[model samples]
Target: MTNSTRIFLFFSFGYFVSYLYRGVNIGFSGFLIEEIGLSAADLGLLTSLYFLGFALTQIPAGAALDTWGPRKVNGVLVLVAAVGSVIFALSDTMWGLMLGRFVIGVGVAVCLGAAFQAMALTFPTHRLPMINGAVVALGGLGGAVVGTPLSLVLDVITWRTASFWLAALTVMVSLCLLFGAHDTAPLHNRKRPTMGDQLRGTWEIARTRAFWQILLFPSIVAGTFYAVQSLWVKPYLLDVNGLPGATVDGLVSLLGFAAVFGSAASGLVARRVERWGISLYHFCGLLLALFVVTEVLILLDVPLPRAFFWISYGFLGGTNALIYAVLVETFPRHTLGRVGTSFNMLVFFLIFLFQNAVGWVVELWEPISVGVYPAQAHIAAWVILLALQTTAGIWYFASKQPKKLEHL
Candidate 1:
């Protein structure tokens, strides 16, 4: 295989593990609640710790990528995720699960950024929109597996055993990345920036108004998308739509399947439209707005086919990834690791908040049963999500046309 192909496959597998961990909780939530006596809030706290760990590591991980390159950085850190998965599999207590999830988050935090960094270094800039989308789509199969496939796995084995398998998979990926993937062509005559210099560059990227404008809407939207996909959607299906376990799993898998297409199409369409003078930024905004509409329709509990809104949610939701391509166009390539991770920090931190908030909101009402919450509770949380996303969308659309960042 070509070196570039090797890089894509290995790095993409790393991201697949990352995405798998993110959504694994969805498949395991019922098992956790029944096995560990977890409440909705407790489940939220545990599931979101992964995102918290992921968010916390973004800045530092970015700096490491710039200094040591993606292969070395991701290889070493993903071992931490293996350790975490072991912890999670063995733990019966809430605190133990939270710790495991957080460590896993820290371990895999670099997966997406590293993959994108390696790709950007290898592929031409014009091709990144499509390539990045393809990577996300392929990685999204991890998400797809956590749905019906995970349910089927759990039918034969326990969640703990499944987690053990996941850990082993993680370890294998780490070893392959460390041994199989070559580092980017090194900087030859240039002094590698000190950690301080790398951090300062990150700060410079952070301070740009255009950066906030470009990232704000999609960050919130992506956070909401992940929050639901990872945790609450199962409960929502159970309580709101009154769907059975088998049906819910199928729909969840359908959402995952739909998102893969959404991800693949976003870049292809964005690149295609750019020839007609449409900006990537505007295309992302349009999809995000349509995503908001999907949420509204979902909340309205419209009598339309139940699958329709979910398919729309998955499809439109995945398109937010197009923002990365937009960032590539706006920022210098040298700063991309930092810029990408900084954006990730915001997206995931918000996911951390949004996931917990959904649970906290649901907890406001009494449960209909041992673990099932009332429909009103979920609707309230869903409305709050809409309000936040819609407000961010408005700000994005209302902002002045983005100008080039002065610092870059």
Candidate 2:
């Protein structure tokens, strides 16, 4: 294979493992709760800690990517994540589990950002939207693996054992990336910026009003989608619909499959849609409206077939993939790393808050049985999320047009 293809495949593998680590908890949530006696709040905090670690690493990760390149940065961090997986596999207590997950978060935190940076360096700017979509589709494949496949594996092996094997696999992937992936030539011949300069550059990106306007949609929609997909959705199906383990796995897998197609199609179609005269802002607004509708259905507990709810949620969630393309088009290549990570930091921080808050909401209600929270609690959380998304949609429609960056 060509060097570019090799790099793409290596980074894709890293992302696959990153996503698998992110969603694996959903498959094991029931087991963890039952075996460890974790309450809803405990579960939420545990899961959110992963995102917390992820968020905390973003700014530094961005600087590292710009300074050292994705190959080294991703290679080192993913190894750390591998170690976290091993810790998680060995942990029997809540604190140990939390520490493992947090480490995992920090390790895998660079997966997407590094992949995007590598692609941006290697590919033409116009083609990046499609490339990014494909990478995200690979992430969906990872999610799919952790769904039914993980469930099947769990049936045959304990969750801890599965985690152990996953850790070993992660180590292999990280080694491949370290040895096999190639990075683009440096964009500049000037001296590397000092730490203070890197921080100032990040702040410059953060301070832009246009950045905030563009950020609002993804921060709310992507954050909520991730919060549900990564932790709560499967649990909701189990507790509310009372689906069997195999059936829940099947549904979650279907959602992951749909997300794969959705992300790929969105990336492929974005340029064509722009040519057709629809602004990215309006396109995102349209998708957010659809997402809000799906949340409303979940909020009302409308007895529509389970497939419809899960599939729609997964598909609409893919709309957030386009945000990466928008950022790529809006920023200069020199600063793309920081811009990408800044966006990620906000998105994940919101996810951290949303995941924890949802758990708190659920905790307020008494469980009808062990580990089964009331449907009302879920509905309340969904409603709050839905409202926030709707508000963001309206804000997008009413806000001033985002300023164009001539650097692109």
Candidate 3:
């Protein structure tokens, strides 16, 4: 295989594993609650730890990607994830599970940023939108599996057994990434930035107006989307939509399946819209708006086919990932690692907050029955999330357009 193809496959596979780790809690929540006796608040705290660990790694991982390249950084880190999976599988207590999840987050945190940086190094700038989308779509398939496929697996094996199998898969992927992935020729000759220089570069990326302007809407949308998809979507369906367990699994799986297409379409559409003179920023805003409208419908509990809204959510929710392409266009190629991870840090940190916030909001109301929060609690949580997202959207549109974008 071509070196570029090898890089893409290995990094893409790593991202696939990362996404699976992110969404596994959704499918396993029942097992966790039943076995560990977790409440909504406890489950939220446990699940959000993954995002917290992921968020913490971004800046430093960005530097490492810029220095050692993705192959070395990602390969080594993924082993940590494998170890985390083992811990999670063996643990019975909440603290043990949280520790395992946190370690898993730290391990896989490099996957998305490293993939984006590695692709930027290997592929032409113009092709990145589509390539990056394809990567995310593949990762979304992992999300898809964690829904219904994981449910089917749980029918035959314990969650602990499933986790152990997942860990083993993670270790195999790590070896592939370490031994099989190749860096582009330019990356081999690039100068290593000092730790001080990398930190300064990361801070500069964070402070840039273009970064924040491009980030606000998309980050909020991505954060909220993950928060809902990873944990709360099942509860919402159960309590608000009154769907049966089997039906909820199917719909959740459908949402994941739709995301695979949606993220892929976002890239293709972003490229196409640019031909029509629509800026990537505007296209992103449009997707974010569509996502918000879908969330509103869900929050309102509209009478329309429930699958329609969930599908819309899955499709539009992650299209904001295209924002990485936008960042590439604006930033220098050398700093792409920092730029991608800075964006990711905020996005996942917000996911952590949004996930925990939903649980905290729901915790305000008494459960309608054991483990079933009231419909109003779920609705209230959605309202708060939507309000924050809408506020971010308004701020983004009202702000001056980035100078880099004027030419694009």
lDDT of each: 0.89, 0.84, 0.88
Model 3 segments more than 4 A misplaced? 188-195, 405-408
lDDT digits (tens) for residues 340-372 of candidate 2: 899889999999999999999988899888888
Q: Tens digits of per-residue lDDT for model 1 on 303-382?
A: 89988899999999888778888888888777778889999999999999999999999999988798898899999998
TM-score of 3: 0.97
lDDT of 1 at 203: 87
lDDT digits (tens) for residues 143-198 of candidate 3: 88988899999999998998899899898888988888667745522566777877
For each candidate, what TM-score against the reference? Answer: 0.97, 0.96, 0.97
Which residue pairs in candidate 1 have backbone atoms (N, alpha carbon, C) closer than 3 angstroms, thus clashing? Answer: none
**Number of the candidate with higher TM-score, 1 or 2:** 1
